[model samples]
Structures are given as structure tokens and as C-alpha cells.
Target: MRAKVTVMLKNGVLDPQGEAVKSALGALGFAGVDAVRQGKVIELDLAETDAAAAEATVRDMCEKLLANTVIESYGVEIL
Candidate 1:
């Protein structure tokens, strides 16, 4: 099974990297962009065959280590 996890900062959290990227985009003449948020994607291959089980496993990984649940939120997809 394959799973994908997306980890992103929760709203109201400070995102310095996102800010820097936004500034750079404006400097490069992309003025239409009003905001930017940065996040991470993790793809995993698992031995588990069931979609439900794979998704649950990935979500556990995110809660335990992949994401800092206090300041970040994560989504899991089974593929």
C-alpha cells in the first residue's frame, strides 16, 4: 500500500518560511499573490494491504512524529 501525508502549519501560526517565499515572489514581479503557506508532503510505501489500515497507520505516524500536532495539522491519503 501507498500513503501520502500532508503536514501544514495551523492557521494563526507564524510561518517565516512562507513569508520569505511570498516576498521573493513579489520581488520577482508576481504581484498577484496575496499570501503563501508552506507545507510538506510525505509519501510512504507500506506492507499493509488494506486501505483503511494503511490510512490509520499513516495518521498515527503523523501524530506521533511526522507532525507537531500543537502547531500543525495533517491529512492522510491512501493510494
Candidate 2:
């Protein structure tokens, strides 16, 4: 099965990268983009098929290595 892990900074965390993107968009004449938040997308090809087990494993992976739980939150989706 394939899984996508989306890791995003918690609210109140500064996102300089996102800010840069927003600035560039504004420069390109994009209107109404008041703010932006940056996150990471990770795609994995795993052997797991059980939804609950896969989610748990990915959550563990995020907490252990992929994401900083102190400053970020994660959501996992299976495909």
C-alpha cells in the first residue's frame, strides 16, 4: 500500500518558507493571500495493508524521525 504523510507546523509556529512563497505570489500579482503555512509531503511504499496498523506505524515514524512533535502535527492518509 501507498501512504502519504502530511506534516505541518503547529499553529503559532513561524513558517519562513511559506512566507517566502506568499511574498513571491504577491509579487506575481496574486491577490488575497494574507498568509501561508508550509508543510511536508512524504510518500512511502509499504507492505502494510491494514488501515489501523499502517496509520499507527506511520504516526510512530513521524514522531520518531519525520516530524518534530513539539512544534508540528501530522496527518496520515492511505492509498
Candidate 3:
């Protein structure tokens, strides 16, 4: 099984990197972009065959170390 985790800043959180990208886009003449948000994706190859178990394990990983739960939110995809 394969597990993909997406980690992103929670709503209302300040994202300086995203802001910088947005500013650069405007400077590059792509001014239509209203805002930008940055996030990370982690792809994992797992031995667990059960979809439910795999998701649970990945969720645990996110809760424990993959994501900072207080400032970020995570979503898991089983592939």
C-alpha cells in the first residue's frame, strides 16, 4: 500500500513563504493571483495491506511527528 500525507497551515495562520511567493508573482506581472498558500506532501510506501490500518498508521504519524497539529492540518490518501 502507499500512503500520501498532505500537511498545510491551518486557516487564519500566517504564511510568510506563501506571501513571498504571491509578491513575487505580482512582480513578475502575474498580478491576478489573489493569494497563495504553501503546503507539503509526503509519499510513503507501506507494507500494510489493509486500507483502514494504513490510514490509521499514517494518521498516527501525522499526529505524532509529521505535522504540527496546533498550527497545521493533515490529510491522508491511500494509494
Candidate 4:
């Protein structure tokens, strides 16, 4: 099984890196971009075969280590 995880800062949290990218884009004359938010994607190859089990395992990983649940949110997609 394959699992994909996306981790992102919760809404209302300040994102300095995202802001820097946005500013840089504007400086580069890409003025249409009003905002930017940066996030991470993790792809994993798993031994688990069942989709439900794989998704559950990945979500547990996110809760335990992959994401800082207090300030970040995560989603899991099993493929």
C-alpha cells in the first residue's frame, strides 16, 4: 500500500516562510498572488494491504510524530 500525507499549518497561524514567498513573488512582478501558504507532503510505501488499515496507520503516524497537532493539521490518502 502507499500512503500520502499532507501537513499544513492550521488556519490563523502565522506562516513566515509563506509570507516571504509571497513578498518575493510580488517583487518579481507576480502581483496577482495575494497570499501563500506552505505545507509538506510525505509519501510512504507501506506493507499494509487494506486501505482502511493503511489510512489509520498513517493518521496515527501523523498524530504521534508527523504533525504537531496543536498548530498543524494533516490529511492521509491511501493509494
User: The CA-based lDDT of model 1 is what?
Assistant: 0.94
The C-alpha stretches of model 4 lying farther than 4 A from their native spots are none
lDDT to native, each model: 0.94, 0.92, 0.97, 0.94
lDDT of 3 by residue, 1-79 (tens): 9999999999999999899999999999996898899999999999999999999999999999999999999999999
Compose the digit string of candidate 2's lDDT tens values, residues 1-79: 7889999999999989999999999999999998999899999888998888888898899989999999999999988
Root-mean-square deviation per candidate: 0.5, 1.0, 0.6, 0.6
Q: Residue by residue across 1-79, what tens digits does model 4's lDDT show?
A: 9999999999999999899999999999896897899999999999999999898889999999999999999999887
Clashes of each: 0, 0, 0, 0
TM-score for candidate 3, residues paired by index: 0.97
Enumerate residue pairs that collide in model 4. Answer: none
Cand. 1 TM to true fold:
0.97
lDDT of 1 by residue, 1-79 (tens): 9898999999999999999999999999887898999999999999999998888889889989999999999999888
lDDT of 2: 0.92
**Would you estimate the TM-scores of all the predictions?**
0.97, 0.92, 0.97, 0.97
Give me candidate 2's TM-score against the actual structure. Answer: 0.92
